[model samples]
Target chain A: MADPIHQFEIHNIVSLGSIGGHDIAFTNSALYMAIVVVGIAALLVGASSSRALVPGRMQSIAELSYEFVADTIQSTAGKEGMKFFPFVFTIFMFVLFANVIGIIPYTFTVTSHIIITAALALLVFLTVIVYGIYKNGLRFFGLFVPHGIPIYILPLIVFIEVLSFLSRPISHSVRLFANMLAGHITLKVFASFITLLGGFGIAGMAGATLPLALVVALFALELLVAFLQAYVFAILTCIYLNDAIHPGH
Target chain B: MATQAHTEHPGGKPQFPPFNKETFASQLIWLAVFFIALYVIIARLAIPRIGGIVEARRDRVEGDLAEANNLKEQSSAAMAAYEKSLADARGRAQALANETREKLNAEADKARRSLEAELNAKLAQAEQTIAGTKTAAMANVRSIAVDTASAIVERLTGAAPAASAVEGAVADALKR
Candidate 1:
């Protein structure tokens, strides 16, 4: 049986050179990332090439993705959040395509890595801080201060609020990364069970059908998780950005 | 498999692939590069085209609805004009029938009155002619009775009696 953890190992495709003590090289993760980017670009660019008044299949998907992201932004962040549409839209499509592409057998799951998801979550976190300060100036600190709180416990409440506010990026990144990592690992574990059971004989092979069925069901679940995680990530980004736009509530 | 993973990495012992700090730089750099590329493609090309299509369809549908409403108004106006003409025709036909009936009734009245007057004139003339005939017959009857009485007296005496005395006696008998 194949090692479940072996799938996550990043291999160097090309060595770019070392800077300081660290080696900077293109790896399989980078390759898949490039594939995701190109795939998204080609789908969008090619689908809109015809600009058909009545959309064909691919164009319909392209339009649906666009409207989906737009609606998510509008609902969570309101109209003023539209200025960050490009940024939010990019994050949504990138995570969504990366996740969906990773579901295919033998493909590297980009979102499964902590570093990648951390980078994405931190990007959202930093954008919220920077844009909130830029738009609201010192009033952005109002995000940590609640309205109608009594003066007696205000200090403790402020401390807790700051702590939770700081933990947002950690939770946001871990939620996606853990979901992908665990789902893939479980799928591999169940798949290996089928092989282990089948090696016993014809009766063992018959018993292997149970795990096979579970793996099939898990695959379907993972597919849902892939879409759901992307949605959660995008919506959370919108919510965080909303705090920037409207800091108090 | 664990031993293979250990050999796969060049430095020291192999760490868990995700936790390995060695490759973070490459992933971050590439993620930045590709994310920026995707952002440009989506913002520059995809949004404008899709937004334009939706806007155009909305305008077309609104225009079609306005034209449909205009046609309905025109049709209702035509129906009103047709109904007004129908009412006018019905009123004119009723007036024409009334005028023809009145003329026929007046002519019938005039013909009946003239015939009644002609019959009355004829009846009066007939009554006058009968009265004159009756008066002439009475005068003849008196003269004949006088002549017959004188002849009877002369025959009984074997000679003729006087005519005035006979006439006077016949007149006196006729009066009685």
Candidate 2:
């Protein structure tokens, strides 16, 4: 059997040649990311070119996605926070497309890696912290101080809040990466079972079909999860952006 | 618990690659590159275009609504003017009709007065002619009676009686 970890390996698609000590290679994941970017551009352009008063199916879908993100931003951060809508929208689309593309029969799930999700979460975390500090200065630390707490319980509450606040990136990144990794691993394991059992007698092969069916069902469920995770990530980013804009309640 | 742990430790397990500095650095390097690329794309391209599209759409809708409202106001003004003109036309028609009725009444009154004057002149002329006719007939009757009395006297007495006497007798009989 092929090593399961081999599925996570990056394959270089375009050798941009080495720069300094690094290979500077553009991998399959990079190529696909480029594809996703171009695909989204083409889709939006194609959908909007008609600019019909009554939208077609594609345009309706595109507009619906736009309004969905816009409304989410407005509801979470209010109008003052709407300036971040485009960023949040793009993030939602990119992550959603990346996840959906990964679910193809033989594609790499980029989000399955801790490094990718951690980088995204870290960026959000750093952005909020830096912006908060830049905007509010030392008072940014006031975020840790809960208002109206009893003086005796203040210390304990502040400690808990600080710990929870520090765990944002860990929890955010793990939520996406773990879900993808578990789903991909389960799918791989079930696919392996079909082959392993098929090597036996006809009755065993027949039993293997059950796991195969389950794999198909799980694939559909994973597609839903892919969209859901992207939504969750984008909404959380909006929340974080809100915090940066308005640090206090 | 210590004795059981010792037995598990003695059992062989295959060694795997250790998590170390190099692995962490390489992961961080790749992550930094990915994040930089994403941020660049977002900041440079995707966000600007999305913002432009949203703003453009909003402006267009607002402009369209403003234009529609302006047109509606103009249309309402035109409708008001049309109604006023129609009312004006009806008022002129009524005024003209009233003037025409007054003119006809004046013409009718003039014709009636002329016809009444002509009828009064004709009645006076007829009365004068009747009075003249009655006087001429009385004179003729007196002369005829004198002539007839002369003829009767000539036949009865063989000589005509005096004309003056006959005339006086006839005049006396007419008076009586």
lDDT of each: 0.88, 0.74
Q: Which residue ranges in model 1 land beyond 4 Å of their true spot?
A: B1-6, B103-176
lDDT of 1 at A122: 99
Give Cα distance to truth, residue B14, candidate 2, Å.
Answer: 7.0
Q: Candidate 2, after superposition: displacement of residue B174 in Å? A: 13
Model 2 / residue B117 / CA error / Å: 3.1
Can you give the DockQ of every candidate in the order shown?
A: 0.45, 0.05
RMSD of 2: 6.8
lDDT of each residue in B157-176, candidate 2, tens digit only: 98989889999999899999
Indicate the worst ten consecutive residues by lDDT in candidate 2 chain B: B1-10
User: In CAPRI terms, where does candidate 1 land?
Assistant: acceptable
User: How far off is residue B37 in model 1, in Å?
Assistant: 0.4
For candidate 2, give the lDDT: 0.74
Model 2 CAPRI quality: incorrect
lDDT of 2 at A15: 63
